[model samples]
Target: MEENLRNNLIDKLQNNTISSEEREELFKLYNSYQFSKEWNENTMGNFEDVRKKILKGVKLKRNGASRGKIYAINSFLRIAAACLLVFFTGWLGYTLILKPDPNVIVESGKSRKEVVLPDGSKITMNINSTLTYPRVFEAKRREVKFEGEGFFEIQADRSHPFIVATPHVKVRVLGTAFNLKAYKEDPAIETSLIHGKVEVLTAKEERTLSILTPNHKFVVDKIALITSHLPQTKSQIEVVPMEFIDPSNTAPVDLAWKEGKFAFASSPFQDIAREMKRRYAVDIIFENKEAADFKYTASFEQEDVVDILDALQLVKPFKYRKEGNKIVVY
Candidate 1:
């Protein structure tokens, strides 16, 4: 093909009017350039290089080749493959590389997310939750921190124990399934043991270390002189047996959010509202503080946001309205 004729065909091919003959010619050009890496050079520094290469194929100007005769294609697979390989291997003479590390994931919102750690320990994260962890296991010890709420089921290891650190308290578990609730505003931290045992350590000097047994719960309770003095606000670690038809049900509930369910395992009204904020990406405010303690005992059939809210309103007495994507309290 003459240079002028080839340029006309290449332009037509790029414009979607390519005929069978032109398609074959384009493929030939692509293959020729692919094998001829001597002229390709190294343009792997920026991701945009591959982008442009895909939109515009590499074309050489020979003695008689038309200046406008350039091969182009939308597919940039070859460029992507070459650039990715070079970038990851640092062959482009660059010192730094962009590598993503491992993460700790937590879930909670009108629901919870339960995660098993690298060492076989479990974490039940509560609504719109997140957890950060190292990609590889460290030989010394496994450590994780939580923001909102979660339950952990840790595989027991005598030599390497599991440790969970919140802002003020640290709970080390040998091998156990325990619930940890640490809301930022709330003063108390609750660690509910579902199985096995753990040691709860606090920052305060007055309280000694407490050994939490299965079914016994741990809470850091604080109190001030309020309406009644019987117990102003007792924040201490205590154990209470967890009711179970089959206690393992906690895992499904903890993990339901990842599968897209705004779950509520008998969570309170305000607690559920906090979850609504996270799951629905809305703001929830309470007009009354007394509404905070309203307990709910029903499990919801996993459904859409509107359906869940309607069901909750009927099951519990509360008025709510939707403002844009947000649900506000009157």
Candidate 2:
């Protein structure tokens, strides 16, 4: 009799004809009874579709329901669905629904995205970047994991330091504005300070690589850090003055990308190609090693990929042929 009543309630719910009393009864029945193996096998094939229909049907039927009743029913149904998923889908549902990570932020394709952290710090993420941080920062320090590139304007908090961890180096700052470039494929990790102070540290925080000031850049060579054998006392970081778009204006080239500008300062041809690939969502193929190693210094705004390539050709002779979304340069 209980099994028949439960099946009847489920059928009513699926058909969008379940009454308020029936919904309440169904909620209680779901808690008490385990679903049959045959029913689970049949429903598993269209789980997502069934889940969507169930929620949509409930929402449509709740037009005249009281707020308190609606809340109770909605909460119960969500839990019931989760229970069903746990039994039917096994670990996939448990990981995605129950033990989900709430703050793994990702930006894909060729557009930049701005994210405001819990402490009111703003991060402008470049194309193809990921940043992970807790929903609420810890009491001692505000820490985040980052890769690709981003422009950070951190909120000032002397008590709680802001830390950014990348593959090669860890950056610690009290409160500072800086641009970090740490693409996994790139040979070096770069931190360009715009204002305030920041300390670049080794992977384990054992050594201070460099302390950056305004208009300065700190670079870490990944190959050198990996291949070195001796106990070196000197810092392995290269500190350089930030590249300017023009000497007269005093505007640093590093911050240009956030403003929709593509700037490079005597950057290798391959690096330029990589930047273009991210900005334009295209692939660049080098036919010759010499072409790939050619150094170029230029800044561009409001130009298409082909136009930029044409401009580069004027500076140095190179032949390139377009093949769909890719450009092959020789």
Candidate 3:
């Protein structure tokens, strides 16, 4: 009677009309084969190899037995392949569902992008900059991550502190306007507070470097601290306090981007080139090291890259040429 039942199931599987009850029975048989001592003793290999081994083993066991047993073994092989296909399909579906999507992302390529956060805070991202935040602000505090440069105008919310996190440092503020510059390739991280108050801290140790006030810029020389032989402590890190250029001016130098202008005061030529690169999305190469070492105090309003470079030349005797997307200075 068992032989007749097995033969009927095998016929149904071969004809592609196997019933649900027959599939359950086949699963039980497959499980038994999987946990058997013979299966465990066999060295594990690829799925194909394992399937072949199982088929070979079943055939050998029923050799010279009866035709019904041989048919049952073939039926098991078909079911095993179907089970493997289903397993992979289910796994692929699970992975797709679990993948995460960026809740809020702002990217500025050759131009700037203005983003308003959920808490009514506004951020103006500079060229080649990126800012990411969650879809909703957390109950306790509002947090966001940033790369490159951004000017933030945060709404007043003393109850919930707003935090901006970067690779090198973190800035915490209740309600204030500030500018943060933290590029991965840059050697320093700069935070300039325009109004209200903010606290800057190192990312690694969460050590508060300084509490900044309006019109003050805080600079952390990361390379100098890392290479220095001094004791590696929060106290040893070099934090420079520099005053914004022309406080009497309507907009401080740090906030010049908001007015479509670039301002600098006694800034190194190399540093100017870096700022030009960020603003124009073009490369500024210095062919002469001496030219790069010069310092200039200047500002440009709504000027193109060539115009800015020409203005710099008026202050200092230097030559520049444009080659495609790069400006070569000598």
Candidate 4:
């Protein structure tokens, strides 16, 4: 009776006419067999061996059959072949299709790019940033790897939490909008939460460093953490409060790039030069080291490289000259 029921369930499944209850029963049976030690040990071998064994059994049966019995025997062989084909196909599908290569990489170079993930989450990637994500999310979570800078607006899926991984840190959120800056060349990794909540973890140890709420910013010095071993002292990671108090009410300083605006609050000249190169596709060379160390507070909306440089000159005395694709600063 049990064998008959199992065969019937498989038939229903193959024919695509299985009821929900019957499907559940079939799944239970599949799970039981899938977890068995014998199944694991046997299923690892090549499928061709199983096919050869089935053919051998059919050949032995054909030789033993009489002329009158041959017609019945042939019919039985046909059914047996069909059943074997279905069983092997199902087994292969279960073993192979369950764990596919999930990594799908998206990168932006020389220009900013926007990406929409499988789960409706959106990422506005800065120039030279790369994002690696699964083609399809796993059962319990949605995760992605990110390099450089990106502003993320994640969809609300509390059951399947979203995670973004960088070289230095991992940010996990159920649903949130945030900006992440984690350039390999940069000394620090920064996460500024616009809304909702996010938990930050260290990449090497998977230790929960901080949990951020709306209007909070988290910064970690990569060099400090790597060079020092002061567990009793203050951690290299720091959390600070940020306000959205721009006169135009556009966005926070960290997230202003998403609006095609370059806004900086006392940012170093070298850092500004790096951002300028990414935004304008031009190389900036500081002739003087003192010029690179200068910090400036400024904002520009769709300004040309020459115009921005001119504006900077008015605030702080600096000489700049453009030659071909390169700008020399002193």
Estimate, for each residue in 194-282, the C-alpha lDDT of model 2 and write its tens digit. 99999988777777778999999988778766633344623555799889888785678888888889999988899999888878889
**Over 4 Å off, model 4:** 1-101, 227-236, 243-245, 248-250
Q: In terms of TM-score, how similar is model 1 to the real structure? A: 0.52
TM-score of 4: 0.65
Clashes of each: 22, 0, 0, 0
Ranking by TM-score: 2, 4, 3, 1
Ranking according to lDDT, highest score first: 2, 4, 3, 1
lDDT of 4: 0.80
Q: Cα RMSD to native, each candidate?
A: 21.8, 22.0, 15.8, 21.3
lDDT of each: 0.60, 0.82, 0.76, 0.80
Query: Tens digit of lDDT per residue, candidate 1, span 169-236?
Result: 77887777777777775655667776788887653323335788766666565332121124434434
Estimate, for each residue in 1-330, the C-alpha lDDT of model 4 and write its tens digit: 755675676566555576666765655555565323333224223334433433444455446556549888888999999999999999899778975666878889867899999999999998889999989886698989999999999999989999898877789999999999999888888999999999987776447788998888998888765543466424777788763438765568888777778888777889899888878888999997898988888889978999888888888888988899999997
**What is the Cα-based lDDT of residue 256 in candidate 3?**
71
Report the number of the highest-lDDT candidate.
2
In candidate 3, clashing pairs total 0
The deviation in Å at residue 307 for candidate 2 is 0.6
TM-score of each: 0.52, 0.67, 0.65, 0.65
Task: List candidate 3 segments past 4 Å from native.
Answer: 1-102, 225-247
Off by over 4 Å in 2: 1-104, 227-236
